[model samples]
Target: MKSTVETLSPTRVRLAIEVPFVELEPSLKKAYREIAQQVQIPGFRRGRVPAAVIDQRVGRAAVINEAVQEAIPAQILAAVREHDVKMLGRPELETFPELEDGQPLKFTAEIDVRPEIALPDLSTLEISVDELQIADSEIDEQVKGLQERFATLKTVERPAQDGDYVQIDLAATVDGEEVPGGSATNISHEVGSKQLLPGLDEVLVSMSAGDANTFTSQLVGGDFAGRDADVSVSVRTVKEKQLPALDDEFAQLASEFDTLEELRNDLRERVTRVKKVEQLYAARDKALAELVRIADVPAPEGVVREEVDHRKQAMADQLERIGASLDEYLAAEEKTEEQIDTELAEAATEGVKIQLLLDTLADAEDVQVSDDEFGHEIMHRAQRAGVQPQQYYDQLVRAGNAGAVFGDVRRGKALALVMDRIKITDAAGNELNMDDLRGGSAEHDHDHDH
Candidate 1:
C-alpha cells in the first residue's frame, strides 16, 4: 500500500491511496468463498460450490464490491498512520474505483485535521485574581442559616407572612370546568416563596386561618398550562419559626462546638477558606481566557458548526420536555431568535478553540492520565450523578465513551500545567501560588466538554 496527502487547508487534508492488486488478493478470495456458500448451485452441496460457478451466477462485479467494502477501512487507517495525519473526525470517501483484473486499486479520502498551533510562552502570561475577603456580615449570614436549620416551627394565630409556613387547600377551574391534577387538600407551602403560582404569594400574605380567596392567574403547568384559571386557596393554619437564643446551650445543641463564640470563629474561618478557593477558580479562568486570546489558533468551521447544531438541538429538546416551544422560551428570556443564534455560535467557536489549544498543549507537554487519575474522575462524576462507580464505568464502556473520559482527564492536566507556569497576582499585589491552592494537583483544572 502507498499513500500521499494533499493539503487542502490548515485543518483539512485529502489522502490519495493506492493498493497493489496482489495486496487485495486475500480479501477477494475470502469474498468469493463467502458468497459461494450463500448462493445455491443445482448440482453442488452448499460449501463445495466452485468459484467459477459462483462467478458465473453472481458476476465478478459483485465479488469486487464486497472486497472493496471490506478493504477500505483498514486501508484508510493505514494511510492515516503512514502519512502522520492528526485527523479529527471520520474520513469521507471521495473516490473509489471498480476493480480491473490486472490493475491496482486506488481511492481518495478527505478528512478534517488538527491545525498547527503556536503556543505563547507560559511564563509571560499574567492575570489578576480577586482578593479573598470575608466580611463580618457574610459570617453573620452563615450563622443565621445555621440557626434557621435548627429552629422549631411554632403555631401562631396570625395572618401568614413571608418566611412563614402555611397549610392550605387549593382548587382551580378553567372555563367553569375542573382542571385535571389541579386540586389538592392540606398542601404545605411557604408564604411568599412564589413556587406554586405567579399570584399565589400575593394572595396568601393577607389571609389568616379559615380565610379563603380566589384569584385569576395563568396556569404554568399541568393540563391547564398556558390557560387562565381561577385558583381558590383556604388557609388551614399558619406557623412561624421560633429560633433558640444564640447562647452556649444553643451552640451545643446545633453543633459540636460547646461555646457560641467558638462556633462563630469556626464559621468565619470556613467562609474565608471558601472565598480563597473562589479566588483560585477566578485566576484559573482568567489565565485560560488569556491563553485562548493569545494563541489565536484557527478553528475548523465544520467542527464549530457541528457543536452549534448539537447545542441548538439540545435546547429544543429541553424546551419540548417542558411543554414549551422555542419561541415561548425566547420570549420568556427576553431574547430574539437572532440573539440566541449569535450566542450559540460564539460559544461554539470558543469551545472548539479551547479544545484545540489544550490538545496541542497536552502533546507539547507529554501529559499523561494515570489509572488512578482516571478512576478519580469517574468516581467524582458518579457521585454527582448518584450512581455507583462501577455502574458509571460500565455505561461509559457500553457507549464506547471510555476513551472520551481519558481525553478529558488529559486535557485537564494540560490546562493545569499551563496554569502552574503562569503568574497570578491578587488585588493586594500579593503573588499567589497555584500549588498553595491545588496542592500540586490538577484538581483545579477546567476543560470545555466539546
Candidate 2:
C-alpha cells in the first residue's frame, strides 16, 4: 500500500491512496467467500461454490464493489496515519477507480483537517481577570440558608401570609375538565414560593385555613400545556416558622461549630473557595479568547458551517423534548431568528478556532492522555450521567467516540500547560495562580509541566 497527501489548504487536504494486488488480495478473497455463501448456485452446494462459478453467476463488478466497500475505510485510515493528517469532520470520498483484473486499487478522499496554527508566545501573553471578592452578605446568605433548614415549624391559627408554610389541596381544570397530573392533595408549600403555579401566591395571601379560592394560570407543560387552567386551592393548615437565633447554640445545632463566629468563618472560606474556582474558569476562557484573537489562525469555513448546523439541530431537538419550537423560543427570549443564527455562527466559529489552536498546542507540547486519566474522566462523566462507568465506556467505544474523549483530555492538558506559561494578573494587580483552582492548595504539584 502507498499513500500521498495533497495540501488543499492549511486546514484541508486530499488523500490519494493506492493498494497493490497483494494488499487487496485478502479483502478480495473474503468478499468472494462471503458472497458465495449468500448466493445460491444451480449445481454446487452452499459455501462450496468456486470463485469462477460465483463470478459467472454474480458479476465480477459486484464482487469488486463489495471488496472496495470493505477496503476503503482501512485504506483511508492507513493513508491518514501515514501522512499524519489529523482530520476533523467526515471525509468525502472524491474518487474511486473501478478495479480491473490483477490491478491495483486506487482512491482519493478530501477531508477537513487541523490547520498548522502558529500560537502566540505564551510567556509574552498577558490577560487580567476580575479580583477575587467574597462579600459578607454572601456569607450571611449561607448562614441564613442553614438557619432555615434547622428552623422549627409552629402550627398557627391565622390566615396565610408570605413566608408561611401552608398545606393545601389543589386541583387544575381546563374547560371544566381536570388536567392530567395536575391535581394534588395535602401539598405542603411556602405561601410566597410561587413554585407550584403562577398567580397561586396571590390567592393564598390572607386566606385562612379552610378557605377555598380559584385562580387562573397558564400551564407550561403536559398534554394541556399553554392552556389557561382554573386552579382551585383549599388551605388545610397554616404554619409559621421559628428560626433559631444566630448565636453559639444555633451554630452548635446547625454544624460542627461551637460558636457563630467559627461557622461564619467557615462559610466565608467556602464562599471564597467557590469564587476562586469561578475565577479560575473565567481565566481559562478569557485566556483562550485572547489567544484566539491574537494567534495567526483562520477558522475553517466548512468546519464552522458544519458546527453551526449541528448546534442548531441540537437546539431544535432540545426544544422538541420540551414541547416547544424555535418560534416560541424566539418570542420568549425576544430574539429574532436571524439573531439566533448569528449567535450560533459566532459561537461555532470560535469553538472550532479554539479547538484547532488547542490541538496544535497539544501536539507541540507532546500532550497525551494516559489510561488512568481516561478512566478517571469516564468515571466522572458516568457519575454525572447517572450510569455505570463500564456501561459508558462500552457505549463510547461502540459509537466510535473514544477518540473524541481522548482528544478532549489532551486539549485540556494543553490549555493547562498554556496557563502555566502565560501571565495572568487580577484586577488588584496580584499575579493570579492556576494553583488556586484546586482550593488554593499550592503545596501539591500540578498535573502538567510548568
Candidate 3:
C-alpha cells in the first residue's frame, strides 16, 4: 500500500491512497466465501459453491462491491495511523478508482484534523478573582428563602393585593380572534411575582373574587405577534401565602435542625458552599481567558465556522421542539438571524481559542485521565444529571464526545496544578489558601428513581 497526504488547510487534509491487488486479496477471498454460503446455484450445494461459480451466479460487480465495502474502512484507518493524522471527525470518502481484475485499488479521503497548538508562558499571566466577604444580608436572604419554601397558601375572602395569589381563567385575543397557547382555566398566578408575564401581575392587582376584566398588553417571550394583545382575565378566588413563624418549632419541622440558630448555621454553610463553587468557576474562566490572550497561535477559521453552524442548528432544534420557528424566536427577541449568526460566530471563535489553549497546556503538562478516574467522573456526572451511569456513558461514546468530557476534566486538573505553582493573593494582599479552594472530599454516589 502507498499513500500521500496534502494539507488543504490548518484543520483539513486530503489523503490519496493506493492499495496493491495483493493487499486486497484476503478481503476478496473472505467476501467470496461469505457469498458462496448464501448463494444458491444449480448442481452446487450451498457453502460448497466454487468462487468462479458464485461469481458467475452473483456477477463480478456484486463481489467487487462487497469486497470494497469490507476493505475500505480498515484501509482508511490504516492509512490514517500510518500518516499520524489527528482526525477530529469522520472522513468524507470520494474519488474511487475503477477496480480491474488483479489490479491495484485507489481512492481519496478528505478529513478534518485537529490543529496543533503551542503552549504559552504560564509564569507571566495574572488573573483577578473577586474575593467577596459573606455579608449578614446574604445570610438573612437565605433564611427568608427557606421560610418561603415552607409557606402555606390560605384562601382569602377579599380583593387581591400585591403578593396575593389569584385563581383565574385567562384568554387572549388579537382583534377578537382567539390565539394559540393563550387560553387557560383554573390557573393560580401570584400577583407581583412576575411568573406569568411583565404587566400581567399588575393587571390582576386590586381585583376581587368573581371580578372579570379585559385589558390590553404586549405579550413577552412567546409566539404571539403584534405590539399589543387583548387579554381577558376572570378572578375565581383570592389567596394569601402564610409563612411559618421562624422559631424552634419551625426549624424542627423544616429540617433536621432543632433550633433556629442551628438552621441558620446550616444555611450559612450551604451558602458558603455555593459561593465557593461560583468562585471556582470565575477563576477557571479568568484563567482560560488569560491563556487565550497570551497564546501565539491563531485558531483555524474552518473549525470556528463549523462550531458556529453547529450552535445555530442546535438553536433551530430547540425552537422546533417548542413549536416555534427560528424566525419567530428572533422576532420575539427583537433580533435578526444575521445578528444571531454574528454573535454565535464570535462566541465560537473564542471557544475554539480557549480549547486550543487548554490542549496546549495539557500537552505541556502531560495531562491524562486514567481509566478509573474517567469512570468515576462519568458516574458522578450521570448522577448529577439524573441519568443512569451506563446510559450516560453510552451517550457520550455514541456522540463522539467522550473526548470532550475527558478534556474538561483534564483541563481542570491542569488549571489546579497551575494554581498550585503560582503566587495567588486575596484582594487584601494576604496569601491565599489554595487548599481551601480545592478542599472537598465528597464522592458522588449514583441513585436511580423509578
Candidate 4:
C-alpha cells in the first residue's frame, strides 16, 4: 500500500491511497471462509465449500466487497502513521472504485487534522503575579479558627441569632407534593451561614425553639430541580459557642505547641508555604494566557462542531432525566437555548486550540513521561478520588483511558518547559526562581487539572 496527502486547509487534509491486488489476498481468503460458513450448498458442507463454487453461487462481487471492507480501515491507519498525520476525528471516506480482477485498489480519505502552530519565543516573555506575603492578621485568623474548633457549645433558651448553632427540622413541598430527599429532621446548622436553604437565615434569626416558619424557594437539585416550592423550618434547639481564651494553656490543650506564640509562628510558616504554591500556579495561569493571546491558534471547525454538539446533547440528556424542560432550565439561568449553544461552541473552539497547542509543544520539546512520574500522579489522583492507586490504574486501562492520562502528564511537562524559558516575577518586581519553586526536580509538578 502507498499513500499521498493533499493539503485541503491548515487543519484539514485529504489522503489518497493505492493498494496492490496481491495485498487483498489474505482478507479475500478470510472473507471466503466466513461466507462459506454462512451460505448453504447442495452437495458441500458449510466449511468444505470451494472458492469457485461459492463465487458462482454468491457472485464474485460479494467476495470483493467483503475483502475491501476488511482491508480499507487497516490501510487507512497505516497511511496515517506513515505520514505522521495528526488526525483529529474519524476520516471521511470520500471516494473509492469498483474492483476488477487484478487492478490496484484506490481510495481517498479526508480528515480534520491538527494545525502546525508558530509559538512565540518563550525566552522573551515574562509574567507577573502577586507577591508572596503572610501577614500577622492572617496568622491571628488561623489561631482564632483553632480556638473555635476547641470551643464549647452551650444550649440556650433564647431565639437563634447569627453565629449561633441551631438544630432544626426542614421540609419542602411543591404544589402540596413532598419533594424526594428534600426533608431533614434534627439537622444542625449555623445561623447566618446561608449554608442551608436560601432565605432560611432571615427566618431563623427571630425564631425561638419550637417555632416554625415557611419560605418559598426553587429546588436546585434532584428530580424536582428548578421548581418553586414552599420550604418549612422548625427550630428544635439553639446553642451558642464559647471559645477558649488565647493563652499558653489553650495552645497546649488544642495542639502540640505549648505556647500561643509558638502556634502563631507555625501558622505563619504554613501561610507562607501556601502563598508560595498559590503564586506558582498564578504565574502559570498568567503565562499560559499570554502565550495563548500571542499564538492565536486556529482549531478545525469539524472538531469544534462535534464537541459543541456533544456538550449540548449531554446537558439535554441530564435535564431530561430529571424531568425538567430545556426552556425551564434556560429561563432559570436567564439565557436562551441559542445563546447557550453559541457559548458552548466558543468554549469548545478555545478548548481545542489549547489542546492542539500543548500537544504540538510537547512534541517540539521532546517531552517524555517517566513511569515514576506517571505513578506519582496516579497515586495523588487516587487519594483525592478516595480509591486505591492500583484500582484506579486498572480502571483506566480497562476503560482504554490510560492514553489520556499519559497525555495529561506529557502536556504538563511541556508547560513546565515553557515556564523555565519564560521569566516570572512577583508584583513587587522580585524575580522568582523557578528552580526554588520546583525544589530541584522536573518543574512539571505544577497542577494539570486544566
The best candidate by lDDT is 4
lDDT of 2 by residue, 1-450 (tens): 888899988888988888997788788899999998998888888889999987889988888888988899989888888888887887888766688867988888898887777777899988788988888888889999999999888989999889999999999999999999999999899988878899999999999988999999998777887899999999999999889899999999999999999999999988888787777766777888888888867787778888999899999999999988787798779999999999999889888888888988998888988999889878877876799999999999999988878877788778879888988889999998777665653222122211
TM-score of each: 0.84, 0.83, 0.74, 0.79
* Decreasing lDDT order of the candidates: 4, 1, 2, 3
Ranking by TM-score: 1, 2, 4, 3
Best prediction by TM-score? 1
Give candidate 2 misplaced runs (Cα > 4 Å). Answer: 1-5, 16-26, 95-107, 300-348, 368-371, 382-398, 440-450
Question: For residues 1-450, what per-residue lDDT tens digits would candidate 3 score against the true structure?
Answer: 899899998778989988998888888888899898898788988888898887787887788878887888888899899999987656778765578878888899988777776665666655566775788889889888888999999999888988888999998887777778889999988888877755677778888899998888787535566557888899999999999998999989889989999988998887777665555555656767766666654566667777888888988888888888776788778998889989998888887776666666778889988988888889888988799999999999999889878877776567666666655555666655656655442331112100
TM-score of 2: 0.83
In lDDT terms, how accurate is model 1? Answer: 0.86
Task: Give the CA lDDT, 0 to 100, for residue 400 in model 1.
Answer: 95
Kindly list the per-residue Cα lDDT of model 4 for residues 1-450, writing each as its tens digit: 999999999999999999999999998999999999999999999888999998999988899988998888888899999999998977888866678867888999998998888888899999999988777789888998998899899999998899999999999999999999989999999999989788899999989899999999877777887789899999999999899999999989988999988988888877776777777777877887777778878889888888888788988999999888787788769998789988998878877777777888898878899999899888977877699999999999999989878888888878878888999998899999886666423333534543
